[model samples]
Target: MQQIEFQLEHEFVELNQLLKLVGLCDSGGAGKALVATGEVCVDGTQELRKTAKIRAGQRVRMGDVEIQVGSST
Candidate 1:
């Protein structure tokens, strides 16, 4: 699995944006499609919200890529 630590600049990041930030997809649209098709997970539960509010300490996984959200220091 590929691990990515993403430092949030705000209280949260949109799900699709996070996917792109972590290099999981080529674009935001692609990320949305992946989420819509139920290919993403948040904290071990399947997440279908394309614009889900993903805050710090959250873990998002898609296939072999996993992104760990962290607060910006």
Candidate 2:
């Protein structure tokens, strides 16, 4: 699967929050549901915490879609 990276303007961001920020899920509730079902992965590991604190340089995966946090440039 192709990996896409995101650039955050904050020091830390919630995992579920990131899903919405990146247009992954429609809403926070939906994001939470996705995470709760163990559908989300952090740095290649399944992450069940809806509010997982994620920072730059970390990776996230929802099935085949993988996202990484980093600067655009």
Candidate 3:
């Protein structure tokens, strides 16, 4: 599996935006579509909410990619 580290600039980040920020998708809309397909997971469980608030220390996964969110220092 591929691993990526993401540092949040605020309290949280929207799921679709995160996907876009990490280069997983071309845009937030595309990320939403991908999430709607039920292919994304959060903390090992399926995530269907495209705008789910993702905070620091949370893990988001899709296919072979895993994004590790961290709080900005």
**TM-score for each model:** 0.93, 0.90, 0.98
Candidate 3 — which pairs collide?
A: none
For candidate 3, write residues 1-73 as lDDT tens digits.
Answer: 9999999999999999999999999999999999999999999999999999999999999999999999987
Q: Best by TM-score, which number? A: 3
Clashes of each: 0, 0, 0
Better of 1 and 2 by lDDT: 1
Off by over 4 Å in 3: none
> Taking the tens digit of each residue's C-alpha lDDT, what string does model 1 give over 35-54?
99998999999999899999
Top candidate (lDDT):
3
Off by over 4 Å in 2: 71-73
In angstroms, the error of model 2 at 18 is 0.5
lDDT tens string, model 2, 8-73? 887888998899988889999989999999889898889998999998899999988899898544
